[model samples]
Target chain A: MSAVATYVRLAWAWTRALAQYPASLAMLTAAQAVATVGELAALVFLFGHAGRLGGFGLHEALLVYGLAGLAFTLADLLMGSVERLGEHIRTGAFDVMLVRPVPALLQVAVEEFSPRRLGKVVPCAAALGWALAALPAEWTPLRAAAVPVLVASGTVICCSVWVIGACLQFVALDAREAANAVTYGGQAMAQYPLAVYGRDVARAATYVVPLAFVSWQPALYLLERPDPLGMPEWLRFAPPAVAALLALVAAAVWRAGLRRYRSTGS
Target chain B: MEAVIEAEGLGKDYTVAEGPLPRRRRRRVSAVRDVSFRVAPGEVVGYLGPNGAGKSTTLKMLIGILAPSAGRVRVAGLEPVRARTRLARRIGVVFGQRTTLWWDLPLRDSLALTRHLYRVPRADHARRLAELTEVLELGPFLATPVRQLSLGQRMRGDLAAALLHAPEVLVLDEPTIGLDVVSKTAIREFLLRLNAERGTTILLTTHDLGDVQRLCRRVMVIDGGRLAFDGGLAGLHAVAPSPRTLVVDLAAPAAPIAVAGARTVRVEGPRQWLELNGNPARVIAQVAADHEVADITLREPDIEEVVHRIYAGR
Candidate 1:
């Protein structure tokens, strides 16, 4: 079987095991739904008081917010289990993964693929749909085509960040929280218009982290607006390029970390 | 025959941080150093070592779980680290202390996933699983979640999971570390059968002397992260120089008997125990010539005693 097929099979096995605890799974799924809904409520409440956030109106900002959230949700669904690498390393479970014929990365990513995370997508996709319906921009074929590309590139970019962050667990097994600060924290930052942050902070997001390409750059193009920080116009279409490069870097980092692994004493 | 498993100058050095937060010191500790050995195909070799003697580290290097700090290792003609995935298809590993089976999934489900991971054909997988289940007595608990199985049952499941792909070589790290006597015996028997029927090359590290006595014809004793002794089991017994004890019942009570090839270590009412380092027959004959003997018995040192002596001396 191919790696992806094996991943799905492993993940499905876990999901079935999880389904054994129906009540707990239901409660967790409902909890995730409520949490995301609460976030959406807070965004709406904030926009109720102000006319616009960072020059984008409530609907415009919502488009950016929705796109970022959808991408993050998908990335989390696909690669969230990589966060458990620290626990696996601590308990020597990572060593078990290494001995398998399958790639250890695939094993780690699908270790506990929770279906509970699927709840977050409902609210995120709903928000994106609402924004698309409410926005006043003329729907050109090029502009309409950019939406799915934006989300795809954004999901890939977020997955790269997730994996690269997970690689740090190889050196500092206790640094899981520190890695989360960059990934989850970056997601929180990406869910907003870049104009709301200070000039240098937005610049860092553009060049250093490239999180701006996740939603802000493409959303600017989708909304037919000007760049607040005056980045190159070509960067709006550059998320795919950026995502590809980051994926390569993430793969390399993962390989290096695997080599550095110090398996625990039996 | 070509060696199925080979290691040349294999070593691992760990740089560990020690001391308090204010003044930490980094010390280089050698876990394994300049260790090398080989196992021919279909050979069952016992890898005996004390705790923390680099047994697991050596096994990990051979299985490609750890990249050796210095030296080289090959199993089935592939460098372990570079061709780990390829080598994995040829080698099966079981760590007695840990289970590779999914904790919450049923044993059968884990085995099914293993089938996919190793890309075994369904017909082959079913046949192998059936044979393993019968041999390991895993049928009753096949549907039970691994987390709920007893330690012995879980271990049986682990063994089956490892063997489902029918690897050419099996590397076991303490395969009988924790188990009831019956369970241990059963696992040992299964392993012996696996070797005999399939000609699978077996390398195992164990603290249990019974496992060594029953399964391994050749033994390698590692100490201080080095290959201290490697040869047949009889050679390992010779490393300790422990003597055989001879017990003789005399026709009547007498003072410590004078003998040429033996020394009287203990004396009782009508018997004496002599420590004999040479031919027991000659010593018994000499004692018989000096005095009438009722009966005699000789005891050789057990493998455990010889192994303990080796560890303590090292």
Candidate 2:
């Protein structure tokens, strides 16, 4: 029928792929929840001792952590397939994706809908929500003012990392962990106050890639605080523009890699 | 009949690396050398070659999977590499080694997914599935997980999956390589009906000669990454000169009875192998009825021998 209809069908199939394995999906979701809670124990201890680090209190830190965690895990669920894309190309598995009537990029993006990673995501989401409710603040206006921008920017950053990782595999099959290091490390460091990692790491993260925007910067505005660093207060919403730029650059890299794909020996 | 696929001087070159941490070196190998041909609509063509014969490379070129190193290919009026978006909708491919299926999902889920991806109408999907499952005997395994299927079962499912889209052109690579006799027969019969009844153009690359004999009227042979033979099956045989062989395993090894039109070759305990005069099927039938024969068989020379004969003549 229509091209959009075909994409919808393929996306449905990908979701069903996860549904087919209920136990795996359930287990992963629980694992993610537990991990997020476990990470919160650390957040609680660090924030309990010191009232604020780089001007972020307990609730604000949890806000950034939870949203970033959710976005990262959501992207991981699909992007895992993109990482294995090299092996797919090497084994000629990519050929199957190519023969379909849909766009190759769309087909590959939804190819893997992983269910297990939620073992960490659900807990992070809960912690973020819990932190939001427990804090003595106006909840309705805060979320309205910030959550959509938070989700969009976080998604763009995660999607950009996913594409970059996949593209790197196209060039060098063995460099997967290196890509993971940047993605996982970036998310972890950005979830907390940059003032903890000292000035250089925080500044590099702030202006260069702007990983801090997802959690650190925007949470400042929601929490109604000034920048812990000597920088201006408006840098809090900086992640979205950075996210958009990274997404565009990531897609460009992917197109270049597609041209360079030699495929398998056939 | 109009040509559904056309190719001119298509080629693929590959460079392989040698040595891990030792003296580094490299080698350049060509998987496909300038090959060209055309297939008429509603025609079934067989592509045959020994291992590493570039048959697969050429098929990939037609399907837009591999970009050709040189030359051009047009399948259904679209350039394979330059116009893949437009080309993908109208082609169905089955690479027997791969299922193109979701491993964890049920057979039906994967089928439904394909139906959606192809944008098949709900009514059309229901009818196609009913017709395909009937011919391929896929009902029993509809809800079963794909990871649990046997090779033959999977192969049949793959064939059925490929045909679901109702594409104008079908490309099958070694479609019946590991199937049991019953399944092989079913697949062959279904393919024949599809080509004749549905009028779909088919390009088949298979190791099984029986698959070629049963399904295709025209056969193309490639050797050493190059085109070796192209034309009808009759022309193919004429190119092979291993003196048509007739082998008979007798009930009693009745003394190598001198047949008028055939030359007797080797005689074993209960077997007699003979070189016949041109037509061996007629002689074998007559000899089988005349002699006290327990079992009889007629064999075309193996592909290797045929290739050898063609080379010798050259």
Candidate 3:
């Protein structure tokens, strides 16, 4: 049949498989809810007493937090273990991906689905509402449309980092824990204001990996604030723009890595 | 003869590098080199090699999973890796070490999925599943989660899963590597039938030599990333027309008639194996006449011995 048709069929199979383990799925979902809500509660506790840290109020921090949580959860839930590309690539399972008759990224992207991530996705939406209610906002149609678009862009950027991390596994099979700095660490740090860090580091993150686009800058535009970092308004939409660039760059790296994927024995 | 699969001058090179804390490229390692082979339609050819041999690499190239550094490959008149969706519909692949079937899903669901993924007709799916379930003996575990099934049961299910698409070509890498004897035999028999009746061309890379002897008529042996030998299984082991093995069920341990024409290959708890090296008719007649034969059985010189002898250069 068609490629889209095949994806749908396999995705159905994936969902059905997730349905088989109801208790595990429930536990995972609950754990995600607990994690997301727990993190938000910690933010409230810390910032409630402190008043403001990094120029972000408790409610404003939730904006960055909720968006990042939603983006990461959506990508993680669909891609499953692909978020752990460094590990999979270090092992030889990545080779199985290369030999299949589809685009390697497409195959990797569709590899696993985690329903437990719905725990975080739903909570993120709830937190977004809470944050919006707590903080006054000028909600134009453009700003409203930018929310999910930004989330999608952030997901793409995060996935790009994952793909790049996977490509690096060819050189350092174990990923030297540095790959995590790009993937999981980047995800964790992306939810906060990049301005919290030094100019050099934030610039590196913004220009090199471009993770800052996912939240910090876009939050600037949505919050209608002065350019604290002195970047253009368009720069806040860097999540999608950088995601697009990173995606192309990631495809190139994947191709280069495929040329370099020396398959190992079982 | 039309080639369903072809590869020429296939080679893969990997860089081995060590650098700073984050990004560095400095090392070089060549995994496969100068490998070439062709598989014709309806032919069951075994790709045999020891550990570290480039069998998986070759299979990857054929399947379009890996892009060769320098070479060309075509499967069933198409570039599989480049046209994966088309190839997915035309071929079935199974990795013995890992199951593609979902762990939580039942065998039926997995099979139903294969049917849908391959876009098999509804009636065709039912008919094929029923036949495979019977042939692979998957009836008992059809509704059970694939994870819950024993290794043998899971293997049988995987075999059926790979065949659901009725792929014109089946690339089985280590298909029976760790199966029980019964499971192995059942898979072998099924593969033999598949090739005979449906003319499904099979290129199997297996560590299990018995699979080669029983299921594959021709064999390709690769060593150190290169094609070492590509020919018939029998020619790999030179023998003087010793058609059958004399498995003498001796009445007693010392129930020896003579060991002149054949070699006593093994002596187990209660039985003895004689590799009938000479004329089968003469050996059988002489043994029957001389010994009080309680019972006797015949066996074939397996591809295991042949491949072992070849590897050892005996």
Question: Taking the candidates in order, what DockQ does each have?
Answer: 0.66, 0.52, 0.44
lDDT of 3 by residue, B249-305 (tens): 766665434666777777774477777768777877787687666788877655444
Which wins on lDDT, candidate 2 or candidate 3? 2
Q: What's the best-to-worst order under lDDT?
A: 1, 2, 3
**lDDT per prediction?**
0.89, 0.78, 0.76
TM-score per candidate, in order? 0.89, 0.86, 0.84
Task: Name the lDDT of candidate 3.
Answer: 0.76
TM-score comparison, 2 vs 3, better candidate: 2
- In terms of lDDT, the poorest run of 10 residues in model 3 chain B is B235-244
DockQ of 2: 0.52
| Candidate 2: tens digits of C-alpha lDDT, residues A135-193 | 55576775566777776787778778778877897778777788778788787886776
Q: Pick the candidate with the highest DockQ.
A: 1
Off by over 4 Å in 2: A1-24, A50-55, A131-143, A203-210, A221-235, B20-28, B242-300
Candidate 3, CAPRI quality class derived from DockQ:
acceptable
Model 1, B1-314: lDDT tens digits are: 89999999999999999999889999999999999988999999999887888888889899998899999888999999999999999999898999999999989999998998899999999999999989898999998999999999998999999999999999998888779989999999999999999999999998887798789999998777998889988777767766878999999999998798899999998899999977888998898899999999987655456667987776
Model 3: lDDT of residue A76: 69
Worst 10-residue lDDT window, candidate 2 chain B: B299-308
DockQ-based class of model 2? medium
For residue A219, model 3's alpha carbon misses the true position, in angstroms, by 1.3
